[model samples]
Target: MTELARLKFYATQAHPCSYLPTEQATTLFLDPSQPMDAQVYAELSEVGFRRSGDHLYRPHCQKCSACVPARLPVADFKPNRQQRRILSRNADLQVRAVRPAFSEEYYDLYARYIEQRHADGDMYPPNREQFSTFLVRDLPFSRFYEFRLGGRLLAVAVTDVLPNGLSAVYTFYDPDEEHRSLGRFAILWQIAETARLGLHAVYLGYWIKNCRKMNYKTQYRPIELFVNQHWAILT
Candidate 1:
C-alpha cells in the first residue's frame, strides 16, 4: 500500500490594512516552496481563501464583510439583451490559450489599461518581473487565456483551475479599446469557458455592493454570495 502525499504550510502575515478603501482586509502570504495540496486548496476556497498563481490567501481582517466570495452558477446563467450586445460587439476577437509569459505587447496593454482605468491606484505600473510574479510566480494550478484581435494581442486573463470550478484571478486589457468594454467581455468569456468545461461555477472574487469597482459583478444575474459564512443565493 502507498501513502498519500501531504502539503505543509504556515501563516506568514495578516498585516493591518485593507485591499479596498471601505472594506477591511488581511492576507496570508505563504512561503514560495511550500507544498500545495488539492484538498487543502478546496477547503481554503470554501472558507473564503483565494489562490493567485501559487499563493493561498484569505481575508482575515476584523469586522469586515464587504469582500464576500462571489460566484456565478453556470447552469443557470442567462445573458440579457444588453449582455448579448456586449458579446456580439467583440465577436471578432479570438481567444488563445497559451502558457503565461511576459512580452512588450502584454506590458504595454497592461500599462495603458492601468493608466487609463486605474491611474492613481495602489497598483503602480508593474515592471516585467513584477508582472511575472503577479501572473506566474508560484502558480500551483493555473492557465493563461490570451485574447487576440486581427493577429494583435488585445487582452489576457490569468485563471486558476480548481477541482470544482474556474477562478478569474486577474485580467488586463488594451485600454485603447475601452469602448469595446473588454473587461465585461472577458468576464462573459470566463463564464462561457466554465460552461464549456462542464464546470458548475465561475468564482469572480469579492464583491462590495457599494464600491464602484465591485459593482459590475452584480450585473451577472442569479449569483451567489458568501454571507454569514454560508453560500446564499442573491440575484
Candidate 2:
C-alpha cells in the first residue's frame, strides 16, 4: 500500500467536551508511531485534523456534530468594518515570523495570558513543559510569529505552514493590552500574510456555534466549513 494508504486512526473514549461543558466528546487521531509526512498532513488538514504537539487529531464525538472545521479563503476575504479597525488599531506593532524556540520571555507572556484569560480552562496554571510541547515542537513547517511594540513583546501567534495554506495553531497575547485586541489582530495578520504569500486559505481550526469562545470565528466572512465530506460556504 502507498504511504497515505498505510495511515490509520484511533478514537479516544468519551470525555467532557472541551468547548461545550454540557456535552461529551471523543477525538480521532492518527497513529503516533507513523512518521509525519507533510503531504499526508496537508491532505488530512483538508478533512479537519489539527496538530497538537506531535499528534494530529479532530473532534470525533458521535452524538454531537456541533464541532465544524473552518477556514478562510484569503483571496475572497474582505475584512469587515470591525476587523479593518482591529488591523489599523495595531498598525504600530511590528510582526515577524521566526523559528520556533522556547524562551522564558515567551513562556512568561504565555503564562500570564493563560492565567488571566484561561484560568478556568484546561490550560490554567501554564508550565514550561506544557508550553514547550504544545508550541515549540521542531516540526519543519512550524513557525512562531511575534508581535511587538517598540521592541516589547505583546503577542505570539503559533502557526503551521502547510502546502496549500497556513494553520493557526494557537495565539496568546498580553492581557494587559486588552484594547489592542491582539488575539484577533494576530489572525487578521495571518490572513493578510497568507494572501501575500500566494496561499489559498488560513485554517482557523474548529468552531462550534453554541460555544461562545469558538463562535467568534464566523466574524471572518466568506468562511468555508468542511461538512458532510465537502467544503461548503458558510458565509
Candidate 3:
C-alpha cells in the first residue's frame, strides 16, 4: 500500500454545523499523534478534508453534498484591478511568516474579529487555551503570517502548507482597522504568498452558495470547485 493509503481515520460523531443556517453535520477525527505524510494530507484535501482547529473534517452527511473543496490555480491566477487596488491600499503593511505561536495579541485580534464580523456566530470570545487548541495544536505543518503596520500587529493569518497547496485555516484582524479592508487584503496576500512559494494551488476551504460570508471568495476569479470528485472550472 502507498503511504497516503496507510494513514487511517474514522468518523467519530455527528456534531453541530459550523456553517449555514438550519443545517447539521459531523466531523471525522484522525490521530494527530501519528506522523502522516504530506501526500496523505493532499489526498484527504481532494476528498474534502478541511483543516479546522487541528482537525481535518468534511461534511459527511448521507443526504447532502454542498460542502465541496475549492482551490485556486496560483500560476494562472490574475490580480484584477480591484484586487490590485486592495493590495495597493495595504502597501505599507509588511508580512513575516513565523512558526505558529500562541499569544495574547493573536487572541485579542481573534476576539475582536469574531465579535465584529460574526457576533451571532458560535466562536465568540474563545479563550486562550481554546484558541491555542483550535489554531496551534496537533498539526504537523503550520505557520502564521503576521501583518504589521508601523511595527504594530494589525492582522494574523494562520495557514498550513500541504504537499499540493496552501490551505488558509483562519485569519483575524484588528477590528479598529476597518478601513484597511484586512479580510480581503489577507486573501490577496495568500495568493501572492502561494505564487512566491511556487506552489500550484491555494485551497480556500468551502464556498456555500447562499452564505454571504463565503460568497466573497468567489471574487477570486478562475477558482476550480470539486464537484462529484472532479475539479470543475468555474466560469
Candidate 4:
C-alpha cells in the first residue's frame, strides 16, 4: 500500500451519496496531474481505487464506510443455476471487445436505457457529452465490449484491462430486453474472460449491503471486499 500512500489525493466536498440517498459521501481522488499508466493504475486498483473518466478515486467519507471495494476472485468463482441459465439465454450474443470510442449505436442504446431505467438517477436524460466523458477515455487499458444479437447492439460493458484483472467500470444495456438479463450475463462473461486471460480477479467497484442496487455484486461467490485496509473473503 506504500504505492497508494505516496500518491497525492484530493477529497471532494461532501455530497449526496448516489447509491444511498440518506447519506452524504466524499471522494478521494488521485492528483489530476499525476502520470498515470497501466502499472500505476493497477497499483491503485490493488489498494481499492477505481477510475471514473480521467480520475482515479475511492469513497473518502468519514462517517459512511458503506461503499466497500469488492472483487470476484477468478479462480474461486462458479456460476450458480440462474447465472448458467442467463449464459444459455445469451448464447447468441456476439460479444466483441473493441477500442473505447463513441458509437452512435451504443449511445442510442445507452440513452434509451437511462431514460427508461435510471430516470430518477443522476445520469437520467443522458446525452452524448455525458456518455463520452464518462466512458470513452484515452487510456491504454480502456476497452468497450459490445454484446450484440444478429449484428444489432444490445449491451455494452465498459472495462479496463488492469494488470491483475479486468475492472468492470460500468454497464448499460437495452432496458427493453430486461428478460434477457444482459447485465448479469455480462459479469459472468467477464469472469470467464478473466480466467481466459489468467488474471486474479474482476474488480467490481463498491458494494453496500443495505443498498439493493449495489449489493447484488455479492452474487458472485467467493468475492473479496476491501475493508479496514485489508482484502478479506466476504461470503
Q: Work out candidate 4's RMSD over C-alphas.
A: 1.3
Full ranking by TM-score: 4, 2, 3, 1
**What TM value does model 2 have?**
0.96
Instruction: State the displacement of the C-alpha of residue 202, model 3, in Å, after optimal TM-score superposition.
Output: 0.7
Estimate the lDDT of model 3: 0.80
What does candidate 4's lDDT look like per residue over 1-235, in tens digits? 2465687889999999999989999999999999767888888887789999999999999998888899998998889999999999999889899888888988899999899989989998799999999998878889999999998899999999988999999999999999999889999999999999999999999999898888679888999999888899985
Highest-scoring model, lDDT: 2
Could you tell me every candidate's TM-score relative to the true structure? 0.87, 0.96, 0.92, 0.97
Q: Is candidate 1 or candidate 2 better by lDDT?
A: 2
Per-candidate clashes come to: 3, 0, 0, 0
| Clashing residue pairs for model 1 | 53-139, 54-138, 54-139
For candidate 1, lDDT tens digit of each residue in 2-117? 12234444554445443565544556544447566655565666656777656777665566666788888889999999899999999999998777767788888787777788
Once fitted onto the true fold, the runs of candidate 4 whose alpha carbons sit more than 4 angstroms away are none
